[model samples]
Target: MNLKFLYFVIFMLCLGQNLRAQYVEKEEEEKITTLYPEAVFDSIQAKKALALGKGKITGVAFTKTAPLAPRIYADNMKIMLFPVTPYFEAWYKLRNSKENLRKRRYVYMSDAAFRYRLEAISNSVGKFTFPDMKPGKYFLTGNMSWSSTGSYNEHTGTSYGSYGTQADHYEKRYYTQNHEERLEKFVEVKTDGEIVEVKLK
Candidate 1:
């Protein structure tokens, strides 16, 4: 009976090892497939930080072309702008007064406190008109994430092990940030050439 029990334990251990190997292989294949998209879609542009100040700063402007009434209806409106280029980058300083460097916290894309742009824009300077947002202060910012489709390696096992050896390895690095500040607030029906400029807060 003892011999039979010992044999069963050995068989179960071997089965577990085989299952782990298969699962690892399946996960690796899925990871590889996910990294590459179906086709070569438009490239994602990288955004620089926005510089903040008390005075005017160069930012994209937007205007409403159609006659938007207080209680009017519209199906669609065209927005004229430049194609979004990755080279365009800007940064804004949030505070007007001098503060401790350590007290400053760098806000990232995932933060909930930061505001966001309802409509998406590809370029830096362009006219963007969307369904009229409610009359209130809104935050405008950008989010970005990037990854490299590659693998790396490092030494494994102990430096002074009985059978020291090297092994394959892989790593993933993630980077993202956010820019947020109160934008213009609108109360009445904005005219056709209502220009909204993005400036340092």
Candidate 2:
């Protein structure tokens, strides 16, 4: 083989490998993360919502992953109430979409933006409350998460007998899934003494 022709073939092969690697990396990134808008965390707005006032907020967090599956509760789970600032609002818009949320990556938030929020734990029935909340708009979030084993019966083959008699063979199979219910809601306190009722599911 001519030396120049052999060297040219090797260079083309290396270029092809580089392009393949870049394509794979881009695909993985698309599946893993998405760029989101940046917004400054507003301390004043968050502080107002965290203050004590006459307004009250109550809610329950529950989720039914499937029609046939059992309903799961956020029992003993920590819940948060945050002011609907620009940062959280952006996260909500992206997370609330079913197309974007289904078995996909979760939107990331700055630690500072996530900090300084009210928290409460849900009861056995997934009920929670935040008392003396300042009259303002806020976001209530929680997790109603659990996992369970699923199963199905599969037929391997049929066993034939004399006189047209036959028998069926079957086997049981099982699988497990993680049911992550990251729930959120928007609540507005209209009055100092008003009570806001909500279902966080």
Residue 74's lDDT within candidate 2 is 80
Expressed as tens digits, the lDDT of each residue in 74-190 for candidate 2 is: 878899888877777887777666876775857766777678788999999898999988778898887667777899999999999988999999999999987777888889998
Question: By TM-score, how accurate is candidate 1?
Answer: 0.22
The Cα local distance difference test for each model comes to 0.31, 0.81
Number of the top candidate by TM-score? 2
Per-residue error (Å), model 1, residue 4: 86
Cα error, residue 57 of model 1, in Å, equals: 18
The top-ranked prediction according to lDDT is: 2
Alpha-carbon runs more than 4 Å astray in model 1? 1-97, 101-110, 114-117, 122-125, 142-201
List where candidate 2 sits over 4 angstroms from the true fold: 1-36, 65-71, 94-106, 148-151, 171-177
RMSD in Å for model 1: 20.2
**Candidate 1 on 115-139: residue-level lDDT in tens?**
2223444243332343333222233
